[model samples]
Target: GAALAERVAAAGGVIGRDDLAAPTAEWAEPVRQDGIWVTPAPTRGPALLAALAGERVLVGGPTGEGTSVVAAADGEGNAVVMVHSNSHPQFGSGLVAEPYDLVLSNRAGRGFHPDPGHPDGPAPGRRPPTTLHAWALDTRGTGRPDLFGATPGGEQQVPWNAQVLGDLMTTGPDDLGAILTRPRWSLQDGARVPVEASASAVRPAHVLLRVTGTGLTAAADPRIGAVALGV
Candidate 1:
């Protein structure tokens, strides 16, 4: 389909009148990793949740850098929604119309395949898997609903957020700045990006971290510079 679109759009190519139909967007069930919910949105919510579960991090930490959610139902039924994204801008270029002045070019349909047997196999107008994550929590006393999201390409966003959660829950960083200033993610992909630390701290052997609050806690990989700030 991509090939067709590119060729048809080539110089003086004979593309049928109906060939250029309006594109459509669709939604599907979110993927779950380690009990955390993840949607394919170019972010890392599920991975973060999983890491937090592993670490057993609690909410109400002195300094944690993640967005979480909480919900409660009283005798009278009611519903609420609260969401937040890290709001970090991607910095690069390639695609046209740099509306955000950043390179989301890596998000182009590369992992997708044409074979039905493959996990990322292509289907007619089907949406590709995204890295974005949406999480929620619910309890009786208080209702806190939060959404932690970002746009780090690949899975870079997960580890960054997870480490911050660890610092907040386990290491007990004094403030948000201290947690962030600590030596952060070291990319697994050495060929692409070298792993580096901002401060002198032992890096985890595994490239994953998790955080948990009173209602729900989650972890993510920070290798992609993913962060989870409060809404």
Candidate 2:
């Protein structure tokens, strides 16, 4: 709210607390390509869209890095696309629920800056950065739809989703299970995880492989114990 107040005061706009309290959600028309329809969840959608649109580019596969999925289907002549993610890493490790097999991790409590001028700085109930996302796509005039989601820390998800989508479209994989299983990720600092089949794949320098996909395919980071399945 302080950000809004600062902006309003700077622009001489008549904004008040009531205006901020009554904010409403907005839904724009779905984005489509060919017979495919896509929609992204809030926040992370724009970045994912940019990656898919070529405004941004990524040159690897999605593994321990973060990622989102887009599903497409047709219906009588309409297409649809959807994207979503938490956009942050798991900050809490103890909050687990077995009934639904859910882990109640704190997502929106990251990316905080200690600067008092920032909006997320030292707030009483501020949410942290989230890393979980859901992305979907549907084709025009069709009933079937494809959905994708992932849990990797921020920024990483964008490229992760793009790579998976490319695999689905260009290579025609039956499911993302295989791709996800053997996925690899590179950090912003140029350190890659789950080392690929290169000399650098072996480790002691970086994180070691936690889970292995199929032969020379993919693997999860052992640190996280994430799993992938193929049929």
Q: What tens digits encode model 2's per-residue C-alpha lDDT throughout 15-63?
A: 5566567656667554545433334433454456666777744322222
For residues 19-116, what per-residue lDDT tens digits would candidate 1 score against the true structure?
44656556656655432344544334555676567743221111112233322222233322233322222321133322333322323243355467
Q: How far is candidate 2 from the true structure (C-alpha RMSD, Å)?
A: 12.0
Worst window of 10 by summed lDDT in candidate 2: 203-212
What C-alpha RMSD separates each model from the true structure? 10.9, 12.0
Go through the candidates in order and give the clash count of each: 39, 57
Query: What is the Cα-based lDDT of residue 96 in candidate 2?
Result: 37
Best by lDDT: 2
Model 1 residue 23 lDDT score? 66
Per-candidate TM equals: 0.44, 0.44
CA lDDT scores, all candidates in order: 0.38, 0.41
Error of 1 at 58 (Å): 25
